[model samples]
Target chain A: QQQVKQSPQSLIVQKGGIPIINCAYENTAFDYFPWYQQFPGKGPALLIAIRPDVSEKKEGRFTISFNKSAKQFSLHIMDSQPGDSATYFCAAKSAGGTSYGKLTFGQGTILTVHP
Target chain B: GAGVSQSPSNKVTEKGKDVELRCDPISGHTALYWYRQSLGQGLEFLIYFQGNSAPDKSGLPSDRFSAERTGGSVSTLTIQRTQQEDSAVYLCASSFRTGGRDEQFFGPGTRLTVL
Candidate 1:
């Protein structure tokens, strides 16, 4: 079973627009959520992250809105630029267990920003 | 500071052949992880190593897949009898600690193609 589920396998937006990617998870033990960005032929890079303690966290143009009760989180890119075109992935990690700190990733979202 | 790195950025091999992929973690990082990303799919966890503890290999797909971390810094993932379905990008990551709050630094993955 896929632990984290992401929607909209592909997304296209004009420059300066906002692109939102959402993810949902069923495991309540997940205490950390993070987003990663990857370009062609490269590994995914950390984009942004959030903890269940806060409802939202923003870094530069990236924002992570997390709803603990809903078991959902979304990534919003403000003033999206053409350079933001890449694959985005959402991941979760549990605090403890045999799988402690091992990330469970969601299906990736390929985002394209047209200039 | 140097980040995680994987060697043989791309590999092509025939079925039934054996292949080995390597990862060098950032200096002093205590946690290492391996993941596989199939085309247009989410990352599937493969294995994890933390300190001197036995690795968590539960995510390994089959008996043919095995990984080892030597001296707590370098890792090698070996696949015996490669199959076409094994084609994917194998990513490696390292974290400063095993806590859920620590950010993982990823390496440029090794793309393996089994023909």
Candidate 2:
């Protein structure tokens, strides 16, 4: 079973617009949510992350809006740039359990920022 | 400091051939993980390794796929009698600990193609 599900398998956004990617999780045990950005021929880099305790987290132009009750979280990139074009993945992890460090990833979303 | 590094950046082989992918985690990181990314797909968890502990291999697709981490720093993923469906980018990541809360540093992945 896919523990986490991501929507909009592909996204096209104009430059300077907000590109939002959403993710939902089925397991309540998951307490951490993280977003990664991957460019072609490169490794996925950590963009931003949030814990269940926080409703939202902002790191510069990247913001993570997390809804604990809904078991959903999203990544919002403001002033999107063409340099931001890449695949995005939303992942969840369960801590305080034996399955720690083993992340459950959602299907990736391919983001294209059109200049 | 160097991030995670993977070897054999690209491998091409015929069906039924065996292939091994390698990963070298960052210095002093206690947690390591393996994931796969197929064409136009999201990251899929394969296994995880923590210092001196047994790895979590629940995400492995089948018995033909196996991984090993030695000295808590390096890992190898071996696919035996590979099939075309097994073709994908194999990624490795490392974290501070076994818990999923820590940020994971990822390597540029090894692309394996079974012809």
TM-score per candidate for chain A alone = 0.98, 0.96
What are the Cα lDDT values of the candidates? 0.94, 0.91
Q: Backbone clashes per model, in order?
A: 0, 1
Writing each residue's lDDT as its tens digit, candidate 2 over A1-115 gives: 7789998899999999999999999889888888999999999999998999999999999999999899899999999999999999999888856446787788999999999
Q: What TM-score is obtained for chain B in each of the predicted models?
A: 0.98, 0.96
Q: How would you class the docking of model 2?
A: high
What DockQ, between 0 and 1, does each candidate earn? 0.90, 0.82
User: Which predicted model would earn the best lDDT?
Assistant: 1
Note the residue pairs that clash in candidate 2: A101-B100
Give candidate 1's error at residue A23 in angstroms: 0.4
